[model samples]
Target: MTTGTPPPTAPKRSRARTFVPLAIAAWAVLEIWLLTLVADVAGGFTVLLLLLGGIVLGAVVTKAAGRRAFRNLTETLQQMPGRPGATAAPAAPAGGSKGNGFLMLAGLLLIIPGMISDVAGLLLLVPPVRAVLGRYTQRSLDRRMRSAAPGSFSDVFQQARMHRPDGKVVQGEVIRETDPQQGPSRNENPRPPLTP
Candidate 1:
């Protein structure tokens, strides 16, 4: 009579959940200080040009890589079990809605400005990570089904009015009061069946 474990909660992989903002802020201050130093030593034009080039390069790289990775993820998901299938899904790319979401989010994080985030995003985009996430979700579903209460139609009718959490209770009652006309009314005699 053991209850099953609840599904694991969504991982708090959000950037807002951590002290990452402080680190990012520190880096930003350092960048500002470096910019000032460069402005004083070298021509400001050189610094401006370098910054613009970096921005362009970052944008282009993320766009190209994210597009390719997302396509792979989409194809994998389209071929998962319970999906409309023509050919079998490849073994390398795993598939599921959750897997796809994780990959997409990972890609997005990678696009944002940080090396650690990019690496983490790349790992999520990989096929192996998708497989792991999918397997865990499946096992969770299986455990839930196994632990579900088993019941039948008879059990349903027996406890029609009551809520049965375990689905194994037969707890209800049927009051059998005689009809007023068939039995004597309260105002009528309560002796034997009145003999005329």
Candidate 2:
């Protein structure tokens, strides 16, 4: 990858780049290592029970969070301000809805079959931990927004007039006669292609 800037030119198109397999391999290795250590002391069946319990609990948590989010949304809509010249409705309180997204993420992590994931998910379920995480996330986003330039999107290829395959399209100015074929339709004023 070239780091330094080159002379000004059109921007490059974004290319897809993902590390899904690499991430899965690393996560599986760590999880297996941790599970083996736990199993050596607690026995294999106990490990199985823990993993199964985590799945069940994750599902319950996910369902509860969904319901809570829906309820909060309905309440907010009900509290929407009335039409013209009236006092505005009070906005939802600060840190309101209490990070329904984080709760759902916690549930998802717990659903993943790994001890490390379960621990992380459990931590996210705590209110104090969620608050700290929320503040940190907000600050990081604010810093990113402040540092980055919001340049306009590139307009390359926008001037193009995309065409259809139908033969009915006409691409010339109208003549003020009943029929132009009766007179000279010169080569200098040749009609443009019906499709461009």
Candidate 3:
């Protein structure tokens, strides 16, 4: 944590980062050209048919691939060891989910009224792209955590312990009873004393 200078914003591997999006964009440009030509020469109904076909194609491909993608992400996160009793390891500070979410959002940007969105969505869906994104996000988080104020981690740990899943504090004090004889004996059927 430097006092004045900000941490590096650039990713460790820029080439890797650029490749997925660029490839997707290229593919999308081709699709757009072909689709537009078909629409122009074949007319609107043909274009609509192609669009539906494209959607089904994408869905089938993604369905076949998406489970493995989720598993990889989940395994990576699960392998990350947090301090004892913490539910989730403080993810690489950019938050891994945030990057994945951003990629998903990029889908919207790439889609509306242009082929760019389709390309963008494809890039985002690609596991390689997400992996790079997660790596960089983790790096960013590491730097930020190093620079955070002292006691922040401990404070967070304590807070996590206090709150249950539904937001209630599960903490309670224990009290010991001293009388052993008054306690029920194992397997006993002692009669209750008669009322005085």
Worst 10 residues of 2 by lDDT: 152-161
lDDT of 3: 0.61
Error of 2 at 89 (Å): 1.8
Model 2, range 63-135, lDDT digits (tens) per residue?
Answer: 9999989988766666665634434756654454888888999999889988999999999999999999989
Pairs of colliding residues, candidate 3: 93-141, 110-117, 111-117
Per-residue lDDT of model 3, residues 1-196, tens digit only: 5588777697577786879999988876887887788778999787786556546555555554455457657756665656344455444533333344545444444334344445666677667787788789889988987777767985575567666545554455444444687786566655555443
* Candidate 2 total steric clashes: 0
Q: Model 1, range 1-196, lDDT digits (tens) per residue?
A: 9799998999777776576888888866766777778778887887677555544544564566567667777887776666777356455653333455565566566555443454566676677887898799889977765665657444454456466545564545544456867885667655444233
Report how far off residue 110 is in candidate 1 (Å): 11
The TM-score obtained by model 2 is 0.62
TM-score of each: 0.37, 0.62, 0.34
